[model samples]
Target: MATGESRARSIGQQATGRTVLKTHPGSKTAVLVALAALVTGCGGSASDTAPTKPSAGHRAGSGSGSDGSSAGTVGFDTVFKTEERFQQALPDPASMAGWTPRNASALIEDDPEPAARCAPSRDWECAKIAHGEANFEAFGEEADFDITAFVDKAGAGEACRKEATWSAKYTKAPGAAVSDVESHAYYRNVGGENGLYVTMCLGTVVAEVTLAGPNSSLDPDTAHSLARQFVPRIQKAAAAS
Candidate 1:
């Protein structure tokens, strides 16, 4: 959980209209406004207009994430499989880690919408990310990635639009790609959940792992460290078929 002092400092900063990330905030401010009126993390993402969807990057053709991709296909079951994969992808509170890693309370499917929005009257208005179509294949139904991780798809030219479209300052985590059509992996605080969210985007395929404590934990530093440690492993597992 966030230390009382730390929470006070964060509240002070936000009250002044200043953000936790100032220099490298993405293109827009992202706030994960949920069913409650909560202002979460803020970061930058891609532009407003939807970019052209790229080819399916995950192992859709092979029918499993561990089985390297062959034919052009995309789906969650193949990308996210074992519960261990999901567990290892985030911090483990059961092991005395800062937060408990579990399947997201809700899963977001891939959509080609330009932006994430909410009705002002819904008490849930925030700068959420929205994305467009992809050039990949779906795992028809037997897929299990959906069983493990929450997925979100977005297109921003030749980049991991889903990762780029977040409201946090993203430092390059280890093993993240360095290319035009590359994946951008990162993590940041999610205030509403009182934790941090780790996002790994391999083009159209995105895995969202939240590390939050039941006790209102807000450990951004731990979140980043955990993300740096786990994202690479997840990527490797995704590649190892």
Candidate 2:
């Protein structure tokens, strides 16, 4: 849970609209209007989108790796799977200890509060933590890596598009050469179960991890690491969830 002061600070930052992605002019109006309608129809105020209930039977997949290492399960809600090679490619955590969350909550809060927009999953509990938004999805499923930890660096084209508006910033992991730094982007599947969307970062050394669920908050790097540590444990929990 976040302290009152922390939450207040977060709210203040949000109110100032500092990190809101600058959308293209032609589409910006439409997007904002559509988002407004979504909030209104969901019985959520313009500012609050947290849901009141939990989703049921969120099926996840669980499996073991060829080497007998635990390959985590994927739930029905799971959108994409990370390849083993990709997980192995991540840089050592020791090299990234200094790569702490940099205003990570800003990244997570890019979207509206989910608690009002969608229900929490039965396997998980939704809460707003200090680091960011978090969804305590009970892992009944298992996988080799936490699918969420992987960050997506925007592609060249996307990066170029973004560059037209704002300068792109790249942070290289300690000891990682400039060439090793890569860009990725957030991906979400649309058209299913209210269409799940995820906003996260991907780096050469960092793996992708789920930042938030439908009605949860995102956690910072430390929290993300803690969650990653439980990748194997959560595989079981997700299977059970």
Report, for all candidates in order, the number of backbone clashes. 19, 55
* Residue lDDT tens for model 2, 132-190: 12122222211112223211222212322332223123221212111111323232333
Deviation (Å) of 209 in candidate 2:
9.1
- Stretch of 10 with least lDDT, candidate 1: 1-10
Q: Write the per-residue lDDT of candidate 1 for residues 1-241, one digit (tens) a residue.
A: 1011110111111224543422213223222211100111132111221222223541212211221213222322334423333333322222211111111211122221223332222221122222111111121211012112322333212123323544335443344332222334343444543433445444233544343434424234433333343344445444545
Residue 13 accuracy (lDDT) in model 1: 19
Off by over 4 Å in 1: 1-159, 166-193
Task: Give the distance in Å from residue 237's predicted Cα in candidate 1 to where it truly belongs.
Answer: 1.3
The top-ranked prediction according to TM-score is 1
Residue 127 of candidate 1: its Cα lDDT? Answer: 21
**Which candidate tops lDDT?**
1
Those runs of model 2 whose alpha carbons end farther than 4 Å from true positions after fitting are 1-68, 74-170, 174-228
